[model samples]
Target: AALIVCVLVLELIVRQFPAFVIELTVWGLHKEIENKEVNVADKEAEAKHQQHLARFCRK
Candidate 1:
């Protein structure tokens, strides 16, 4: 599915540049929260980012 590809791409980015990806993810989440535009898809992506961040951090 498209969603799986998106997640895989994000995971690859995270693996290559974890710090940058984490910063961007945190900024995006903060902006979404501040604007109260937290849609289901946004939440799902945020969750995926967090999951990937955690996985990478354990390395």
Candidate 2:
């Protein structure tokens, strides 16, 4: 009886382990995408500031 119980527990953990890993992977991907967007926005703001400064100096 104890052996059977152990087998059941092992099976459950094996089946659920992949699901946990997949969730973590997807969450990590989302965080990475969010960071990438932030970087892009910062670059765009810097570019716009540089353009404005150029135009100001031209005047």
Candidate 3:
């Protein structure tokens, strides 16, 4: 009886482990996407500022 209970618990954990890993992977991907968006926004702002400066210099 004890052995059966232990096996059941191990099987439950094994089934749930993949779900946990998938959730963790999705969370990590979300963070990576957010960081990339911030970096892209910063680069765009810098490019716009450089263009403005160039126009001013031309005038």
Candidate 4:
């Protein structure tokens, strides 16, 4: 639901601004910083910005 939209927005933003992506990764560890990241401190909060992106492996 709303989580999906948030995920999409952050995904796009990270793509456009990679620096923010890194900051977001570490920030996830601290719930307090989550809000500073993007008002996502509680479960009711949007569930975007997952930990891993799951990159593909080509060999």
Best by TM-score: 2
Cα lDDT tens digits for candidate 2, 10-50: 98878998997898899999999999999999999999999
Model 1, which residues run further than 4 Å from truth? Answer: 1-38
- Least lDDT summed over 10 consecutive residues: which range in candidate 4? 50-59
lDDT of 3 at 18: 94
Pairwise lDDT winner, candidates 1 and 2: 2
lDDT of each: 0.88, 0.95, 0.95, 0.62
Residue pairs clashing in model 2 are none
Cα shift from native, residue 54, model 4 (Å): 71
TM-score-wise, the better of 3 and 4 is 3
How well is each residue in 1-52 modelled by candidate 3, as lDDT tens digits?
A: 9999999999987899899789889999999999999999999999999999
Q: List the candidate 4 regions with Cα displacement exceeding 4 Å.
A: 18-59
Lowest-sum lDDT 10-residue window in model 2: 12-21
In model 1, the Cα lDDT at residue 13 comes to 81
Query: Candidate 4 on 1-59: residue-level lDDT in tens?
Result: 89999999988886878777668766766756656656435533433323222222221
How many residue pairs clash in all the candidates, one count each?
0, 0, 0, 0
- Model 2: CA > 4 A from native: 1-16
TM-score versus the correct structure, for each prediction: 0.36, 0.55, 0.52, 0.29
